[model samples]
Target: MKKPLVIAATLAVVLSLGLAACGGDDSSEETLSNSELIAQADQICTDYNEQLDTMNEEAALDENSSRQEIATYISDDLVPLYQEQVDELRSLNPNEEDAAAYNDIVDTLESELQVVEDDPEAAIDAEDP
Candidate 1:
């Protein structure tokens, strides 16, 4: 994928994962303070970034890999990773103040991920208007 789109997709994954890691249980009346939520979310992103960095490093080692191979890897691996993040985010049941923004992010990421899953090569090759 183009650098910008790749960055955007990565960011979407980070944010979604952060939101997903927050919490999912509805029985608890306790809610995290905004600062606490931010801290937790940041930690989740940090961990995910580290994992992604490793994956990128491995991909980079294969100098002879074709665009199709890269796209296939992304579709097979990253798309499901993004989807897992989305699923986790949905389970969070975020508060009203953050729900709208979180939902928007999740929706955009899910749609983009779907496009990648359907046709990874086209997604990588697509140009911005």
Candidate 2:
């Protein structure tokens, strides 16, 4: 019984240390391969595209897009930090399909932003003519 208890404690300590190493900031400063970076950008674009589609169909977006900090977060969190990665990926593979996808997403966001900026009240509600 005493031997088993000591073994269990040692196992627990080892497991905890392993977990701590894995849990630390998963975002690595290590450079991503071109393909990996493109994949990440593609996913972001896809998500942003779907979100804007929903917004357009339901309600026009206000400056803040119904309190969603998407633009805010993208600008501050994504762009500032990862813009270089995105640019690198684009420059490396300018003609990639994912690059076009990313551009479409950006265009959608811009259009939505314009709608909100041009007509704040109209954007807040979805009333078709």
Candidate 3:
């Protein structure tokens, strides 16, 4: 269960960063350098990862916590956080050079988040080793 949760969290960071790396103003008149785009994206991922790490640590401190409780947290808390990140990523207009890759990552993250939102319990179950 923890494995799956960790994997999902890691993927969220990776995908968010990937999305960020390509983000910029959509205007043809304005474009960010690749380094600038990556830096911005990296910051978003850093913040997101920090929050996720804190949540995981807090959850770990509760040895008596039930699977249901974890599931509830993931669904009610974590999913919303991921959604916010995704929303932020979507708002960024990628540079022309990175648009295709950026859009692909954004789509993938949206799909992954939808699955977790729709059936958080199943997601938890799938993590069982």
Local distance difference test scores for all models: 0.56, 0.35, 0.66
The TM-score-based order of candidates, best leading, equals 3, 1, 2
**Between candidates 1 and 3, which one is better according to lDDT?**
3
Total backbone collisions, model 2: 0
Candidate 2, residue 51: Cα displacement in angstroms equals 0.3
1-129 per-residue lDDT for model 3 (tens digits):
455355455446545645544644323456556666666656666677788777777656243556687678778778887887777666666677876787788788888788878877665555432
**Backbone atom clashes (below 3 Å) for every candidate:** 0, 0, 1
The candidate that wins on lDDT is 3
Model 2: per-residue Cα lDDT over 3-94, one tens digit each: 22222222222222212111111134544444564455455444444543454344332343432333333333323223332232233332
Best by the TM-score measure: 3
TM-score of each: 0.64, 0.30, 0.74
User: All candidates: CA RMSD in angstroms?
Assistant: 4.9, 20.2, 3.7
lDDT of 1 at 44: 51
Give every collision pair in model 1: none
The lDDT ranking, best first, is 3, 1, 2
